[model samples]
Target: MRWSKPLSALALATMLAGCESIFGSGDEEPITRLPRALTQSEQELIVASNRFGFNLLREVSARDTSSNIFLSPLSASMALGMTMNGASGETFSAMRSTLGFGTMEPAAINAAYRSLIDLLLGLDRNVDMRLANSIWVDQQFPLHPAFVESSLQHFDARVTALDFGNPASVKTINAWVDQGTNGKIKTILEQIDPEIVMYLINAVYFKGSWTQEFDPARTSPAPFHRADGSQHPVQMMFMRDAEVRSVMNDQVQMVDLAYGRGAFSMTLVLPPNAQPLRQWAAGVTDEKWQGWIAQLHDGKLDVSLPRFRLEYDEVLNNTLKAMGMATAFDDVAADFSGMSPRGADLFIAEVKQKTFIEVNEKGTEAAAATSVGTGVTSAPPTFRADRPFLAAIRERHSGTILFVGLIGDPRSP
Candidate 1:
C-alpha cells in the first residue's frame, strides 16, 4: 500500500470550475487509471489483506521442504468480536434491540466499523507490514434471540474447515467475503455457527505482485523436492532471472514483487544456497524487514514463483492481550457497560478466526487490502512490490496497525 502519489495543489475548490479539467487526460475527461473507491468494514480490509499475504507466500513458503510453511502466530492469534445471547438479568433492551441488523441501523454498524478503521489505519509512514484484520458480522450473523432478549451472556464465531452446502448462509457469508476479497476469495466463514448472536470481526491480508508474472506457458509440472529428498509432481510457477538482490548476513538472495491489480506486494528472501527457512524466520522483526527493504535498489532481476493456497486458524484471545486490547477482550476487566449493564461481566468470551487464501497470476487469486492515513509523504498512487519485503495498510491518517501478518506459504499449514 504505497501512498506516494502526488496530489496537485490546484485546490478542488477552484479546480472544480466548469473550465478546469480535474481529469489527468487534460480533455476534462475522467481518468480511468484512478484507484478503486474506498470501501467499508475492517474485516473486509482483512479479506484484502489475506489476498496479499497469499501472494507472497508463493515464493517464500517453499524455503524449507521439511517445514517451510508460514502461518502467522499473529495471524492465528489476534481477533476481536462481541456476541450476546439470552439476556435475562440486566437491562439490555436498548442494545439487544440492535440484534441481527434488525435492531441496529446500517449507520450505527458502519459507525462502529469506522471507529475501528480509524485506529487500525493510524500508521502509514513506516514500511513494516504483513497482514491486518478488522471484521464486523452484524448483517450476516444469524438473528440470535439474545439480540431481542435481556442481559446477554456470551459470544463465539468459527470459520468452517469445509463449506456447508447451505443456500442463505452461504450466500450471506460469501457475499461479504467476495466483496471484501475483491472476488479473490468466495467463502470465508462458510461453517458459521447459526446459533451464535453477533460477530464483530476484522483482518488484514496482503501480498505483492510477482516480479515475473507466472507465464502460464512456462509453468510446468515439476517435482518440488522435499528436505527428506522425497519428490512429487507439483504444479509450480517457475522462472529464472539473474538480477535478484543478495544479502550477506543470512547468505540470502532476495527481491520484491507485486500481485495483479497492483493492490498488494511482497519481497522474497531465499538462502544463498537453499538455507533452512525455519532458522531464518525465527529472528524476524519489524525493524529488520525495514532495513532489508531500504537496501533494495531497483535493478534488472529474474524471479520464479509457484501456485499455492492455504487456510489459517487462530485463537486471538492471547495475542490481543500482548497487543494491548486485553481489557476489552477480558471478561473480568472489560468495561463495556456502555454496551451492556452487566459491566465487567458482559465482556468478550472467545475470538476465533479462520482465514483462507490462494495465490496465482490472476489478481491476488482471491485478495483483500484496506488502509487509511494522512502522512507527510502522501502514499504514491502506485507501489510495485516484486521482491521479499514488508508492507502495511496504514490509515493514511492515524497510521494504525489495523491488521498485519506474514505469508510464508499459502498452502494449508
Candidate 2:
C-alpha cells in the first residue's frame, strides 16, 4: 500500500448584505489577465506565507501529541485572503500581519495570488490539480460592488446570492464544495445557521503519479519506531534510485520524491533520531526549509517509507487567535466594512478546515477546503506520522507547500 495525506480548509462568517450591479457586464465577465511575471514583493509574500504555514503546523501538532495532523495552509490563506479584501483599519492590519501578507498592498496580494494559482493549475498536464473560490451571500444582505468585482477579477470567485436561512442553501453550498474538491469533501456546510450571512469558501485538489513509480514487489514488513521507544510492524515501501535528490545535515536529512514530470514532489524531512516530531518541527523555519532545497543534489540513498493514509479535521479559531488574528474573531473589534454594506454588524464567527490524503507506490492524491464566515454574531475554530514524521507537498518552481502532515502511527486506519 502507498501513503497519501489529503487536506482541506473551511471558513464561515455572517453579515447583512445586498448585491449591486458592479460585477461587470453580462453573465460572462472578461477574464482578468494575469501577469506573466511575478514582482519581487509578490515572490516575498509567497515565501512568507509558507513560513507561516509551517509555524501554524507546529501549533496544531502541539495540541495532540499522539494524534495525526494534515492541513493545507494554502487553502486557509487563500480563503482568508479573500475575506481580508474587505477588512479595513485595525482589522485589516491585524489580518494582514497575521496571514504574512504584512504591509503589502491588497491589490498586489490579490494579483500575486491570481498569478500563482494560474501558474500552479497550468504547471503539469499530467497532474490533476484544481483551486477554486466562491462567495455565498445571503439574499437579504447588501454586499459592496467592489468586493464582488475584486473577488471576480482577482480570485476568480463565483459570487452567488442565496437564502441563507433556508436549508436548501446549505445543500447548495455543500454541493459546490463537494464538486470543487472532487467529492473528497462531501459536506463543508452541514446546516446554515440563521445568523450566518455569508461564506467565503476555498477548495484545493491534487492528484499526481510518481515520475519514477516504485515497484510494489519491493515492499516488505519493516519495524517502525515510535516516540515512546516502542516498535511496530509496518509495510515499508523501498526505493533505491540513483536519480533521487537529497540533502543532509546534523539536524536532519531531506529527500525529494518527484511526481508528474517533475513539476511537484513530496519533500520528506527526517530527524537525526526518533525524537518526538513536535520537537524537531519546532526548529523548522523558512531559512532552514530553503537551505534544504538549495542544498539538494543528485545522490543515491535507499529510501524506505511506510504505507499509510490520513483524514484530519481541525478548528483554527484558537490557533489563529494565538497566531495574532485575535481581532478578526472578536465580534466587537472585528472590522470587515470593506466586505458588506453592513460591515459594522459583522465579525468572523468560525473558521474550519477538513483534509484528506493518500500516498502509495504510484503517486499521491489530496484535497482541502477552507470556509470563512462573517456574521452578526461570533465563532471560532500532521503527519507522520510514522514514529511521528513531517512531510510536505510542494510545487518545485515556487517552492509553495500545498499540504503539511505529521504521522504519529502508520497502523491507524
RMSD of each: 15.4, 11.8
Backbone clash count for every predicted candidate, in the order shown: 90, 53
| TM per prediction | 0.49, 0.87
For residues 1-413, write the lDDT of model 1, one tens digit per residue.
31111100000000000011111221232212323333444434333233323332332333323232333322322222232221222222322231212243333444444444343333221111223332232332222333322212111123222222344654764565455444444454444443332333323443333323556677555554444455545455544443333333444454544322222244455533444444455455434545655665544544444455554444334533343344444334444343223332434444444444455543232233221000003321222122222223222222122223343332311
lDDT of each residue in 306-327, candidate 2, tens digit only: 8766677878878888888888
Off by over 4 Å in 1: 1-175, 182-197, 203-212, 225-229, 240-251, 259-263, 271-275, 318-329, 338-343, 368-413
Global lDDT of each candidate: 0.34, 0.74
- Which residue runs of candidate 2 sit more than 4 Å off their true CA positions? 1-37, 377-386
Q: Please give the lDDT score for candidate 1.
A: 0.34
